[model samples]
Target: MVRGKTQMRRIENATSRQVTFSKRRNGLLKKAFELSVLCDAELALIIFSSRGKLYEFSSSSMQATVGRYLRHTRSDQSHHLDQPLPHQHDLQAVQNEAASLLKEIESVEVSKRKLLGESLGTSSYEELQQLEQQLERSLSHIRARKHEVYREQIEQLKEKYDVEEERQQSPTQIQLAEVSPNYGESSSISDVETDLFIGPPKSRSK
Candidate 1:
């Protein structure tokens, strides 16, 4: 199985960072030496540690290599300058597009300001009428929505009132059910049966 590549990043732990720095620094210096010998290539490498220590490798003198690098970088910049720039037509097209976009944005801003009752000096009578009509339509929608909300609130209140009324009347209904079977009978003394005889009279036996 292929081994996973080691992640390339600075180590956070002080001890581990120092250890990794030492190992990588030696490896880099070794690679520079071998490349110079085998490939016979002119090259230079410089490294600085966290302690500000300097380490470097060069196939030739360091000063000569650095000077050559400077010259080559400057020549590249001059070569780029010598090359022809993009066509003027392309540049003009891009400038025209940007100007068109700016004009369109300005027009939209003017329309918005006019709608908000600002910058009305340039607007015509027709434009004012149109803005007024748009505002009326918006107000109509708002009023309709307000009425809908009022109706919904009224319905909610009605439902809550009915529930409360039922709760209050349930106990009265239960009290009616608990009434006595003879509930409507009269309680006055005159309503009772009365008899004048105190004892029973018996006939003589034959």
Candidate 2:
């Protein structure tokens, strides 16, 4: 039978747990030693057991190796030393920003009035021409959009008329309108019936 893979979890039995820990720890240390010697690499391995016992191996002095690692890791951080770290804007910076925004608002308000034909005294001939062109372009776009809306309304009305015409049609109602064909025609007094007076003032009393 094929052997099942060893389950990678905490060993429940105390004796088995201790045995596994000792065997794995020794194997790990041996592997680290072989890796350092065969490849001639600087290596560090630090392990702490459940009982607080320390196991450490370093190719060089542990402190020196750790210090060298720190130096390499922090090399990029050296450039940041002279640069100011990010923080909230101070009072002076906020004031300056507010002043800049106020000036921008004033400029925008002036431009808005100029577009409405209010402020023309300060505008040059070129500025006036530019404004005129801008207004004409805006008007063209507005008119195009208006025409599109008009077409949509016409289509809706056409569809509505078609529906109403269909509703008025029936199997018996051949080529007839919903309203009377001779609805507004007037008949002479002699052709009309006496009881069905068309426009006699006496009908109002009834």
Candidate 3:
């Protein structure tokens, strides 16, 4: 029967580890070469020993392949180490990038929580006061504009009412002036009729 999965841990024995690395390294390189030859693919492989040894293979020029790898990984060539482990500078850079990404993720999470109304209680009194002030200012501006518009409308209505009143009074004054002369004439004619009815007042008294 095939061996089951082994526990995932670092091998303590140096010799056994070294043997495993060697076997694996050779197998990996052979597979890479075979793939390159069979599929006409460009290939490069890099491996290192635990004792700080450098090993590499490529289907093309090693420099060219390494340059290609550097371009793909966006890693600086100056920081590459000839040893088995990553350089200290590279490790630090990676750590810094990870920390920056973590900070960005945390900021996004906080924004999401705020949007969901989950962090309203966590806001400081100053923040709440500022928000209220902003809201009050906005309302004040809206009310002021509304009042100005209302005042303008009222002034227009008053002007229209004044014009209408002038028109109505002007027609009444014209009618009164036209009737006054006729009224006086009618009164004088009635006085003359009464004198005639008295027979010319007894022929003017001798």
Candidate 4:
């Protein structure tokens, strides 16, 4: 027959309660003895009844077992206390680095504001002079670059003019060569005609 599971509550009758306590206490002690014997374990159990009656079991000396349990718990707590948390140092380092970077960024922002003429009231005369000198140097560099650009442009224009002049005079030179019978035979006529028609070559001035 399948017996229904019993619902546990306090036994209201004092006599029944005492009887149940005696039976369960004996049963628990028997189980503890069996477990120690079967598993060859060091074990201890202790109980006190409502009337202050003591019930106890121990595979070895109860004092020794209790002492060992206390020592084990204390050592575990001490070990945890001694060791640092894994992230503590890393978190501190990251915080320090962040603070340093923040300071650098603020300094750069202040300098940028000064350069933009936004913080002029706070600047000293020496600082103003330094800024003025820096600006003058920058202006000088810009003017030098502008002059270099203009010189390059003029040189390019001069090259283009020389090329066009050569192109235009090429056909005329060819026609003159064909018309003059002694153009290639003798140098006298060619030299005289060159000087008379084109004039002596102009010397370049430094």
RMSD of each: 9.3, 16.9, 21.9, 22.4
Q: Estimate each model's TM-score.
A: 0.52, 0.43, 0.35, 0.42
Instruction: Find the candidate with the highest lDDT and give its number.
Output: 4
Best by TM-score: 1
> How does each model score on lDDT?
0.88, 0.87, 0.81, 0.89
Pick by TM-score: 3 or 4, better one: 4
Candidate order by decreasing TM-score: 1, 2, 4, 3
TM-score of 2: 0.43
Task: Give the TM-score comparing model 3 with the true structure, all chains together.
Answer: 0.35
Instruction: Write model 1 residue lDDT over 35-73, tens digit each, in one string.
Output: 999999999999999999999999999999999999999
Total backbone clashes of candidate 4, pairs 3 or more residues apart or in separate chains:
0
Tens-digit lDDT track for model 2 on 153-192? 9999999999999888785666346445655553333476
Query: What's each prediction's clash count?
Result: 0, 0, 0, 0
lDDT of 3 at 125: 87
Q: Measured by C-alpha RMSD in angstroms, how accurate is candidate 4?
A: 22.4
Across 57-91, the per-residue lDDT of candidate 4 in tens digits comes to 99999999999999999998898897777699799
TM-score of decoy 4? 0.42
Show the lowest summed lDDT stretch of 10 residues, model 4. Answer: 197-206
lDDT of 3 by residue, 57-155 (tens): 989888898788778675544455454455776998999999999999998897567555577687788866765676689789999999999999999
